[model samples]
Target chain A: MNLSPQQQKIIEIVPQGAPSIVEESLFEVRKKIYPRAVTGLFARWRWGMVIFTQLLFYGLCWVPWNDRQAVLFNIVERKFYLFGLVLWPQDVFYLAILLIISAFSLFLFTAVAGRLWCGFACPQTVYTEVFLWIERVFEGDRGARMKLDSGDMSQVKLLRKGGKVLTWALLAAWTGFTFVGYFTPIHELWGEVWNFRLGPWESFWLCFYSAFTYLNAGHMREQVCKYMCPYARFQGVMFDPDTLVITYDTERGDPRGSRKKGIDPRSEGKGDCVDCQICVQVCPTGIDIRDGLQYECIGCAACIDACDQVMEKMNYPKGLIRYSTENALSQHWGWREILRHVVRPRVLIYMGILSIVVSAFLFGLLTKSSLQVNVIRDRGIMGREVEGGLIENVFRLQVMNVSEHYQFYAVKVEGLPGIKLASDHVIELPAESSRVFTFEVRADPESGKPGSNPISFEIESLLGDAEAHEKATFFIPR
Target chain B: MQKWMWILWPSFIIAGVAEGIFFSLVNPQELYFLGDPVHYSAIATYSIGFLAFWMVCACSSFLTWSLQRPAGEVNARG
Candidate 1:
């Protein structure tokens, strides 16, 4: 067939031996994986974790501490109350430190045991597991779900599917509500729900988070871990030969074939593996463990549980698939031997860094001043010469009461001779709140030289012994 | 930084243009922070929004890369 000049040029640009369109397409269509449920030791641990985490997330908002939510991030009030500790927006460095600590913890954990967080504790895994359980309750097991999806639609199918959707929506919406509750008071949020008067921003966040949770957990499932999760992509960089990962013992399980119930695997000239494929069936990511430790494996150890059960039934030794490091497997080292190598230099370094960060974070929190004073010079007017021959400088002082109780603060100025607070120095600040006050500092023109003299504002709490001193630049006429 | 101008320039232009259009369409006075003298709260708000937006953009970029890959091929890590 004759081709256009543009098409001819495209053909010339094509490399030799490159896969044609028929061989490989650009886009990969997703094939749905229906993971078969299997009961095992790790499965029980996962369920336990699900219960533990969900309890803390859904129930923590209701628990009262000092007549307020136990762990509330009151964004509106710009206060973060974590049990006994109250933090202001100025204390965001603490949050950054918290994030750094979490990152280091992940590094340490991933280096020691691969994807332990992903399998058991990560929100994606936990929520997906819960959503799957909900789906199983409405529908049936793996086989039933597969059949229902492929089969014709019916009343039974409609009811079950509809019921599942409704349940998931309600759960996701409640999750969103609880999430919003951490920022807004849960009781007040509940009142708003009753009155249908939730603020637009709050309502938007609630819906947005709910929809995200539902799509991630209910529909996307493993796709979130496989495609979207950056952690999954980058976690391999943290892995080493000593890192414990889910592995299949290819030396024992290879040369595989099926066998009768009572027949010995050696008699049939085959390895211990009967090739039942149960391990693959139970895998969340639908990868064959026998193919080596792939990044796709979350190291949930469900395959270990499945393979062990198969080994037991066949009167064979267990651990055909288990959590073993590359070095351990290569050296044929057992559990005790593996434990010794876990304390190696890389892990020690991570631990040392983590400890330093943790201690520093704790020290910062412990020594945090209850009274915080931030003085900003009024930009509208720099300085003025008053009738009394005093140089007056206006400033906006933001005084934050970081304690749980109300505080009475008295402001005083220092650094220049005869420098004194020219406005009301005493003010009452509410509990865990900040108020911006316009205050004037006056000093005799002869007392200090012109053009930006350093001054300090001392805030002393009358209600408590807490006090803070913040330094600001005082402008003077040149 | 200069070497990657081909990439950085487009990203910078997109961000700057988008920010301008967005601020104009949604009067920043309606926001909790009125611009001019930037407050700590206003800075914090913008910082968080920038972080969240960048993360979402990163995720979408990854997805686009994934779509461009040949079928049946998997990402291999060394």
Candidate 2:
């Protein structure tokens, strides 16, 4: 083969061992990150959060209350049980308020200290940490795991990989089971699992959630935060100069290079950083903090802990990497000044609104009525003339006994002269159940001049102080 | 790849919230589609509703993202 002069020159420029140019794809395949495990205050905090959250998630469903799951969203029964409180479809306003509170709390927390939810508490991070721990038990830590992955497919490698995968699968399955348990009666669901009698939908959800947990935490890891989290994309907008963020003290740590310990770095014209790269090794997201803050940081503070240990060993003051605000980092402010800046106007507004909403939410929960009555006028039927020359109206009443006891309720109709219940005025209702009944109310035709008269149904529970007043319009022929 | 993520992920989150709100107010047992009663159970209805909302939201997001692309790229692709 004859080579052109240009090709010859290219070959000459490229050394014999150097490979030819490789075309890059539009989508970059991820290089796997093997974060070394570290132990420090923040790492312990992360583990603490993992235990607390998982306890709530995996244990809460088994807790019994009123002969049922304490915190169940029983779609089968069309009721949400939160301990003593039962929320029906009509009480969905509470769900909206709950969502609003969540959104506001996110904003408040983000403004105060960035990605606190994502770092220590997020299911994604916590689950990943757990899966990594399991991985460590089988394959070993960062260096060994990396070497094993890079090495030949030996029997040991296969066994370790298989064991890790099996453990992860069991944990993921357990997680998925717990998730489905929230919407179904866990006791019954557990029996169904043992008997192989799980419903199709139940099986589908269990598998779906298992796959989700496995893929998201075990495989995807930081990719979810970097590429897929909606909060990650919008969190920049939530941040101000005073917002506390995981920071690298570039001013203090610049001219970073290695030196012998106990030797003053100033004389050597070097900074506190030993260039050991432990901070980079410990990073889950695999970014150097010295390049300044990036969106990829989940604020996990593994780098901070890693660097602090290095600083301590080097006999220097700690906090080479620390939680600090942009303003504080730039202005070289002390902790006092940083705290003062954190109380900026934006933070105050967030805190103020958060307190208000929290109080309101508590108030709503505390004062929630135990009875619900919906007076829906039956449009299918109109006011009719009964045998006594009286005007009669029909209403479809949906009354819910939101409490935990069977009770008798008396229905009274008013808002017209001598208006009275024409049908059975007393209804027997069971605990936490709703019933639809056709209520008949009659009024003297000459009670008032009326086309559509406003009326109210006064429902009083005979067993307790629970009562409901619902309004409906009664029509009279002109 | 990233463009797809930008469209899908935000819409996915939004769709989840929408499903929660919609199902909370309208019980799946009582839901009717185009004057036809939904025969599926509450769990099935909820799942389908979430998927349908997600599809709608993803379409909206994809359209918005495609429209905002550089005019040269859009025209060249066309």
Model number with the top lDDT: 2
Interface RMSD of each: 12.4, 2.6
Which parts of model 2 are misplaced by more than 4 Å? A1-27, A376-396, A415-419, A439-455, A472-478, B1-11, B32-36, B56-78
Model 2, A369-390: lDDT tens digits are 9888888888877889998899
For model 2 chain A, where is the 10-residue window of minimal lDDT?
A20-29
Over B1-78, each residue of candidate 2 has an lDDT whose tens digit, in order, gives: 678876887888899889887777777888788899999877788888888999999999999988877766778989
| lDDT (10s digit) by residue, model 1, range A1-478 | 9988877754356576976566543224568878888788899999999999999999999999988898998765656789988766567778778888999999999999999999999999999999999999999888999999999999999999999999999999999999989978999999998899986667777897899899989987887777656688899999999999988988888789898888877777888889999999888888899999887898778899899999999989989998899999889998999999999998999999999999999999888888877888899889998879888889998887778787888888899998998889899988777789999889987887878899899889886569888999888898
> Model 2: which docking level applies?
acceptable
> What would the per-residue lDDT of candidate 1 be over residues B1-78, giving only the tens digit for each residue?
222322333344345445433432443324653455434443244334544454555555556555755555555421
Here, model 1's chain A TM-score works out at 0.83
* TM-score of chain A for the candidates in order shown: 0.83, 0.89
- Give TM per candidate: 0.77, 0.87
The DockQ of each candidate is 0.06, 0.48
- Give the range of the ten consecutive residues with the poorest summed lDDT in model 1 chain A: A20-29
